[model samples]
Target: MRRFVFGALAWPPLLERVLGRAADLRPARLPGYAVYGTGGGALDPGTLCAVPDGGAEGLLILDPDPEDGARMAYFNGTDADGMVTEVRCGGDLVSARVALHDDAPGDGALPWDQARWLEEWGPLALDTARNIMAQYGQTEPARMAGLRPYLAARAWARQLARTPAPAEVRMATTAEEGVEILRDRPGHEGFFRLRAFDMRHRRFDGAQSPEIGREGFVAYDAALVLPYDPATDHVLLIEQLRYGPILRGDPRPWVLEPVAGLVDGGEDPETCVLREAVEEAGLTLREVQPMVRVYASPGYSSEFFHCYLGLADLSSYEAGVGGLDAEHEDIRSHLLSFDRAMALVDSGEINAGPLAMMLLWLARARAGLRAGA
Candidate 1:
């Protein structure tokens, strides 16, 4: 039997990739329905939901192959369910399958705006789709849905990685001129992703190096902030038990560090730090001084940091515990004198590298900041 599906929110590039070359598409319209945005992160307004209206315009896929149908199901995830419906293509009435949003709210839904969405979310959505489809045969659709947020974060990391940096002291050759990716073998997919690459890069002497296998731990870009009070010479640090140290066999896993959180897709780093300050330590920061942006580790990870010095008044604020319950965070906030924080750094008590770097940065600017205040 020939199969036809109506897609109201399907991006053309994504549709081409999912439906394959054998499928055909044409303009179509469904009567008594209108599309609305769902407003989710990552692929914001994740998928458009249909509500009763005079009509809605969309695309009709004609005779999609069985494999294409399966791939489409996986792409839509578990929140949408498929059903056969009739839509008009030109003068003809066509029967097609439409993916309905199962939990679409009845009121206050905004109309779908494809142009705006494409401007802000198109690239990230495409990149995220590439990762999600790569695991089609191996991962369940429901599990993939659960992994979508993390996948989107990883995609956001790629976008942030494109930021141009000073290359005066380093080679001017670009990745396009210096490297070749022969193949990519999938390794793992969860909160974090792992991928192995077979590649070669141009050496300084002008010859391509031998192709070798290398694996990378894909991570999100993080916003880290050190809250400081120039008036009292105090800083706020949060203590939490981290998994990395525990995995590395450290007996004392609880470590002190600056306020930090993963930068969500389409979110600015400055905005992220301010939000983290409130969530991690019940502090509302009005403004932040930029510190330095750097990679946590360049050798085998994609973790990057946007560090900042948050200006706040900590003279009367008492130290206490704070963290989001949904994230299972048990964080304790500590208000320490500038000298006391440095003493901990000297004693090797403050082991987190970002925190140490930020404290040193504050030290260099402390006198100037205080003098001005």
Candidate 2:
């Protein structure tokens, strides 16, 4: 017999443990089960069902056990769709399986019993369920493909969870400051304005088109840097956790990016770059060689990054652990020769789009930057 796990309906702490373990077991698909689903309420049974069914076959549900039925009260109020969704969203199933060897919950907040599992997990479980299900829905094998509606059902369940949390925007003084704000408001939307919002204009009939905003919301209104040390033939790249890759199922989500951060209120972009360089990567940026200050992304997010080229002591600085501890930043700086860094970008080793663009910018200005250095 094969086994699968669901964390949503299981319990909160248990679910976290399960996800952590699941993360540990990389590049492997979890087992699938079935849902005797009946849908109602804010939870989308469809989305919940997709996790097991989409990735593997018939793993979300099992035949009702007479001995277990009395314990499965949470399944009682739910329909077949709801039961299955509860299971997927609950994630206890996954939690129970992956973390079976781990210690039981210290408190009653999460119970080991199956019936109590659904109650504790609740509709709030659907978000993680939807995320996992969506990942598998696109990739599920054919036999399990029929269970796709569970993904939809899970989505509905998530809507119910949303009623409680709701979405709201928070304000901040600067982009980095906005990161702090965003960290606090994990689920809710964040909105803030910073001093310098950079945009490029494509002249059309001598008139620039409506500006495009790159990156995400301009929540962190800050400056950007494209650091280059032509004398040392080196550049500064800072690595940190990124939400974009996290959403895309990347295991190691930290990305090596240019020395960039939010420009605090009353500070100029150049000042922001210099400060960020010292704080994030532990490098002293001496000369600021300005480049086209363009928005990183102009479509969805409001992050307007001001790109620049800075001359620094690439060899003197140690390329090791850096960043602010209060913010829980574990950034690793790489002081590589220009050719090596460009090669990494060219070979697709450097995945971040902004870093790639900045690298190319440095490539163009390498000669001049070196001459001046």
Candidate 3:
């Protein structure tokens, strides 16, 4: 049987990755259907929905292997339904399968803009597709849906890793110049991922080190903000039960920390911090100050932090419980004087590293901020 598939939002590179070969594509148009954008959030790409009447233009794949068709279905995710339809290809109407979604747009929904999507989301989508397709026959669609966010975070990490930091005082060598990766494989995948690598790197003495095996936790870029009221000289901190300490067998797992969240793929750190502030503490920030960007632990993890100081009015807001119910977050916000926050740091009460660092940072800038306010 000859198989054909129509792609409206699928980029050529993604199709190539999924098919494991160059795709045989032709320009085609679905005469009685329109493509609309649906279901993307800060962390994921919006997908396409084909609905009756208005028409859409896309590429048609000719004679895709049955296995390739299955792979494409997985890529489309659980929300998509494939239907055999006729599309105009050149001068003739040809039979092809198109993916449609149940949540079709109603009146006045804008048509899907392929150009804008390519510019803003192409890289992340491609990187995410690579990770998704790597699981090919191994992962189920329902399981893959749950894994998408983590995979997107990993892809975003890879994107951020491309920009080099200042290296004047350091080795001044890029990863390309310093490290030679031999084999990289997945150790585990869930809410987090563990990756094992066999690699070699240049030593300080100008010699290539022997190949060695190592493993690292794949994590996300996080935005951390210490909300401060310059007029009141107080700061807001949230207390939450942390899983890391629990895993480490700590008696006290509920720790006080800055309002923080994982930066969604393609989301700006400042924007993420601002959004997290409202979600975690119910306070809208008046201004935000960039504190520092650093690796949480460079030794064996990919976790990084973009820290900030958020200026807000603390006098009107009281300490209370706040957090998104969807995430099952039981967060308690605490409003305290600057001195009291520092006292917590001094008394070992504020054990979270990022929060403590941000507090100390706030101490140095407190005088100027108050004067300016």
Candidate 4:
């Protein structure tokens, strides 16, 4: 039994929850303990005068004035030197203070009878008690003491405001492909990949492809970008050689595409779009506006595309040679009016999906942009 000096404070519900959780993890898993109060003179009789080495102690304090409803509660912790620990419960963070005193025979503060404080308010105190117990002497206690209620309220608000979207699917396409290709395929060590491709209606399952074995193709997130000029109404498109075109047996191997690049690990979408804008087109954008976020081929591939319409001064920075030397990216840019670009899309010269989408969107917004209306 432990001594608790409850001063004009009624027990709250938080204490019960904390003690219930702590009871499961009590020191050495001992028998159930008891909690009472100081009685007779100014305290209740159930208070314990001496707390055992592995027992628990708690205190409840209330303002003496009737109009004052503010209260403070504390848990007497025995972890280190019988220290006083603080915890947050019922919008208040209470700190427990501990002290040792002699049991004088006729002291007015000593209790005459043992009444059950636990039975009346035990369950109510569980949450607060467990919180304080877990945070004994930890930094969390001090932090909770300052703005416990505000944090609770904020958490509630966040819960209410949160709208979770569908989770991105992650499938392993080629962890071992990199190693296998390094040993067997020897030529393209610089670009070893396990790519996921859509096959919604196509008969090409990755299992059937000779390119993959037991280590099947893993799904990947797609990266996309778009370049636009609200001022000149001119957009720059890049023509480049792609491995996919060669694999597909296209007579014209080079394909038309938007100024885009594959997103690398640890890179944000915004950063990637701007970097790709410069690398593929030699154009530095003032501001990039996000237009749409879509999956390139959602039914069969895990590649999601992030499209952006970059606002830039395209008058002077056009028809420039740009590409990373290491990547062997011999990219050429064609700067033309939005109408002409769409005309190319209408003529099948522009075959890339992202480039076509951006051109159509630009067509819808072109009249307003030209009239400045």
The Cα local distance difference test for each model comes to: 0.80, 0.48, 0.79, 0.49
Best by TM-score: 1
- Model 4 residue 235 lDDT score: 82
Off by over 4 Å in 3: 1-9, 39-53, 79-81, 102-104
In model 3, pairs of residues that clash are: none
Question: Residues 1-373, candidate 2, lDDT per residue (tens digit)?
Answer: 1123333333333333223322212121234432222232223221222233333222322322332321221222221212222223233433212212122222222212334435533433444233333333233334223333333233333233222322256232233322221121112211221223334443435454564433333243456786666778877777788888889999888887888776542245788789988888777787887776544565554455566788776667678888899767788887788888888987877998778988887778778767876
TM-score of each: 0.93, 0.43, 0.92, 0.44
Task: Give the per-residue lDDT of model 4 (tens digit) for 1-373.
Answer: 2212332222333323323321211111111222334431211223334435323333433322221111222243212122354423345545543332233323444332323444433332332234334433343434445433222222222222233334467443333332233122212110222333222221225443334322222233334556667777788788888878789998888888877765543245678788888777778888777776776775444355667877788778649678999678899888888878888999998888888987787777767766862
Error of 4 at 309 (Å): 0.4
Q: Which parts of model 2 have CA positions greater than 4 angstroms off?
A: 1-218
For 219-325, candidate 3 gives per-residue lDDT tens digits of: 88898999999999999999999999999999999999999998877778899999999999899999998999999999999999989999998888988998999
Tell me which residue pairs clash in candidate 1: none
Residue 279 alpha-carbon offset, candidate 1, angstroms: 0.7
lDDT of 1 by residue, 1-373 (tens): 2344433235678666555454566777777666666565435433335456646667777666667657777766654446777888899987887665534545666666667777778788777777777778888788887777777777888888887678999998999889999998868866777878999999999998999999999888999999999988999999999999999999999999999999987788999999999999999885798999999998999899999999998888889999999889999999999999999999999999999999999999999988876
Clashes, model 2: 68
The C-alpha local distance difference test score for the whole of candidate 1 amounts to 0.80
